[model samples]
Target: MQNFKAMVLLQIIISIFLFLSQASSQGIGDKSNVPEYAWLAGNWSGNGFGGTSEESWSLPSPDGTMMGMYRHLDSMGNITFYEFLLLDETGIRLKHFRPDLIGWETKEDFVTFEMVRYNGKIIELKGLIFKRKSENEMEILLKLRKGDVVKTEVFTMKKINKLK
Candidate 1:
């Protein structure tokens, strides 16, 4: 009888603790605290010299962030390049992390950037402005110490059909 009572008490205490923990996680907070990257929620496709590539991304919450990854491989089935979405509080960012799996760790040319503007056409981040052409294309133009150059890339994605 005593053992049964002790087990019941323990179960009740555990249930209460679990309920409180879940409730705390649902508390209201600033939108930034949760992630404001809701623009990338969709399926996307693009092509380049490496070959055709596709990616998909969606956020768990309607007001949360979205992310995606893509792979473009060579004829031999070896990945020649890869790209992924980068969504931060500042803005939506994209990164092509690796050109090839071979010795990629030695390459420090990669950078971390965030979005500063979300006007749907021009996104400014880290003092650089990216112009958007259509829903899946963007170009970055900036002045360099050596000269001025413009880098352009195209992305295609559709918001998860199930989500409105």
Candidate 2:
């Protein structure tokens, strides 16, 4: 009777161990590939000189890919432009499409992006970089060049009680 009781206890312990082992083996999902900008994985509203713009970002898929779409409108509430961004193993790419430019403009915009090598408070992606200053605040820098002139603008986005 004692041997049978010991056998049952051993089996129970083994089953528990197997369950825990399997649970741990199930990866926590790779956050390494997730950039600082990942915090933007929701709806955002902001305004620039041009006008107000809204954006929406979604979580990365199982394969580690993320994308966001943004809409731009003038003070008159007319759709001025639309843009989208994609981040993947190859890096990050932003495509801007408006009334004047199509796919051809993507190449030119890509070339103007100035990429920084260091991962300081921010991570660099082409011409834009996102710096995580705190849990709720982030700074984004965008670089643009026209002719021989280079210009950069920094935009700070704060969480405003909305998630999409």
Which structure among the candidates has the greatest TM-score? 2
Report the C-alpha lDDT of model 2 over 22-43, residue by residue, as the tens digit.
7666544545655444565666
List TM-score per model, in order: 0.45, 0.62
TM for candidate 2 is: 0.62
- Residue pairs with backbone overlap in model 1: 41-159, 42-158, 42-159, 43-157, 43-158, 44-156, 44-157
Query: What's model 1's lDDT at 129?
Result: 55
RMSD in Å for model 2 = 6.8
lDDT values for all models: 0.53, 0.65
In candidate 1, what are the lDDT values of residues 23-89, reduced to their tens digit? 6766544344344334344554455444555556655353355565657656566667676655555
